[model samples]
Target: MFIPYCISLYIIKGNKSIYDPAFRLFALNMGFADLEFMALVGIFPAVSYFLPFPVSFNVCKVFGAFSADAWFTCIMLSQMMSLNRFVGIFWPGNAKAIYTKRNTTITLAFCWIQGLIWTSFYLKPNVGLYFDSKNRGLIYDFRLNGTETVFSLNMIFNYVHASSLCLTYGLIYLKIRQDITEPYRLTIFHHFIPVHDKKDVSYEDNILEYKEIMAAPDLNTGWRRKHMLDPKLANDRKKENKVLIQACVICLLHVAAVATWAVSQKIATAKYVLFIPSIVGLFSSGSTGYLYILVNSTVRQKFASMVSKCWCHKANQLSNYEARKKDSGIQSISPKKDNEYSELMEMDDYENVTKN
Candidate 1:
């Protein structure tokens, strides 16, 4: 999961020409948050369980705080992405002005700050969050031994995030349905939103260049931004649909994991039952990177290209090392052969002299 997530990030960042700045900003934040969440919340506690010594409560609390912060940031960013897609589809004309780099950066900063503030509430000595190895999940320590307060707060956050995601996606679906008059609803949409004048449908102004220029070279070398005049040839529209699907898939997976956690917290009394939610949560976090690669064709191609390059590089290095080793062996043997031949020649000369 870590490797895949990192690879996805690398591909996205390395190929700026392939991704819009707004989308790239959101993706980078989400990827970083997931990596942190998985490490601090999932891996650290899991590894601690097998350690020779018992992990102190304070240590768990510290890690859990950081994990909670990352978890909140991821949730917010996911919601933001849902909104971003909604805007891109519903308000194609205005999306360009709305999601400029400056606005997106500020929005990301707000999410991080909000996450920090929320996490601070859990850090109080009376009310704390910590990973419990014995219990196999995050434990909320509330004053008077009542965890209902923190649980309610967390649930509210999830409900808002989940509900907003549904609303945005629902609206997006409706908009697409309205535009797409064909019997096959699943057909790829040629135009996402309808514009009175085709001239108003400025594909260049909306999202960053989403599709690879079919006429251009492969992304391995590099790429130049190319815009299409014809709606059918406009790769942005096709890519927009793809992004929508990708975001929807990620939201569904995330909702499922969060739902599992909520249910486990309320009714799960058995330790084994509690463990299920943690595993689900980890899978949800780890799956996002693979999901990106799976859903986005550009990302998939980029990742494949990167892997192929690395493999070829390693193979070349191995071949070069072997060639050098073989040359050294030949050189060493040639000197010994030369010495033996010289001795033989000297002996021949000595025998000839004796015969004379």
Candidate 2:
């Protein structure tokens, strides 16, 4: 789901579908991070569950270290999302300046590297991980060791991050409310002087196209999303709010899921919540793509179009084969026709069939 949505978001232009290119990129990166966390944390557990691989404690530690990298990256990504929203709302003028492609790339790269740095702290004396039958996955346990301080500090770091995120969004919410009560406007004008001769000159006034960061609201719901007089402006506001709302919901779910997982780790009484621990990060990474598909109408149309095209292609192939048989009085074609993508995907299957 993440893979297809990521591809479609890029190929179909999601910002045009809803928000801007920056949010589209944000969603894409989040999906990629989810895939990263999934690969690091899910694969070994799944493989062990099915085949019972005798992985040594040292090997498990190595895998756990990689998963730790994903953990830290996720933490940093949450902070980035909060900051992105803050800038987009509070300092709309500087949103583009701050959320540039280069800056975003550099920020993500730094977070990943930071994850590696943070993962080092997790490499302690008594921490051990192993595949278990009870959970049907890896179980992480810490024996009597003085390294508990490091884990405690790590938890502190997460708390600080969460607090910062909440603070930023809270500020953004306040700003939104203020804009509703007190409307603000920005304007720009240009004056040009044209000289036809040395003694004669003409002055002309020009008005350049300008867009306000916040449009005035006539008065609406509890707060005020955007008061619309013109159809175009109304549509634009609706699109922006759709992306913002989806992002907010996804972020909230991600944090809640992670929080539950973290709590389950320390609280032995709620051990059944272990499932939440395993799936929260995975869900966080993949949730945005699903939200876009379900909520963003443009993305849905594109996805539906793609699906229809695929079915039509398959139907065409069957119809062509039938036509050939009818015209030539034959039963079948020597070889079936398939698109290049299909052929590439089926190459391994073809080889296996031949070997069988």
Candidate 3:
């Protein structure tokens, strides 16, 4: 958790130009969510569960409140990421204006503030989180009058996020497919027999043009993702596609974890079985860092550089410490030898005086 968080922070901070402005904002927020989830919710609670002493209810409540906040933040960010991809793909012309730095900044602020407001409900005495010893997990208690509304709202939010991801990704897939096939389909409508082809020599050329268009490689495996009309637009589209692919993989993991938790809640299961959902949720949160490192070449390179620097720094420190120790030992031994030499000279002087 710590390593990935650092790597992600480095990528976000050091490699700003690696992604779009909106994408950078989204990635930054997602990093914060992961940090909060891992620090406030994941590591502490997991460690607490294994301790010799039992954790107090109030402490559990506080932890659970923060956990819920992190969870909700992630859900909200996931939806925003989906929307960002959707707009970039469907409206490439206006994506730049729509997702300006100022706009993304405002959106991120709203997301965090919204999370805080939702988390306030969990702070109430009747509505907070508690650990269920039987289930060995943190269980939200929302049956009380005060918490029932919050519970419903949370459920509704989850459903909305899940639904948006599904709809947006579905459309995105269709749009990409359409783009790949449109060129070939349009080739059939072209004038197969040109007027100049009356010479018969040009007839062969027209046939070849039609065939060439038809034989164009599938965009899925082709070097170019789209039949780009302009080089700049093509580059932007390619970047958007890469961003979409990474975001989709991350969001899919989130959706799968949420779905698993929902199903686990519905089933009446054994005591230990309840732990599965929570475990899966943590896994989902933790896995994003690994995914980022694996998928983004820039991030991977930066992480490697950081690791190498740290090791080199440690090695240098160790060498310096050893050199200092050796110098001190030699200094101490030299003073002792000089004192012994002086004593031996005085003894030899005494023997010469006695002989005279």
The collision pairs in model 3 are none
Instruction: Give residue 297's error in model 3 in angstroms.
Output: 1.4
- TM-score leaderboard ranking: 3, 1, 2
Which tens-of-lDDT digit does each residue in 95-120 have in candidate 2? 99888889888887887789888667
What residue runs in model 2 are displaced by over 4 Å at the alpha carbon? 1-21, 123-133, 144-147, 184-227, 268-273, 314-356
lDDT of 3 by residue, 199-305 (tens): 65665687776566557644332223232333444445555566667777777777877776666554524666657777777777877777677766566666765
Alpha carbon lDDT at 236, candidate 2 = 47
- TM-scores for candidates 1 onward, in order: 0.73, 0.67, 0.73
Q: Please list the Cα RMSD from the true structure of every candidate, rounded to 1 decimal place.
A: 18.8, 13.3, 19.8
Candidate 1 lDDT over residue span 126-180, tens digit each: 6677887777888665443435676689889988887888788888887876654
**Deviation from native of the Cα of residue 222 in model 1, angstroms:** 38
Best by lDDT: 1
TM-score of 3: 0.73
Rank list by lDDT: 1, 3, 2
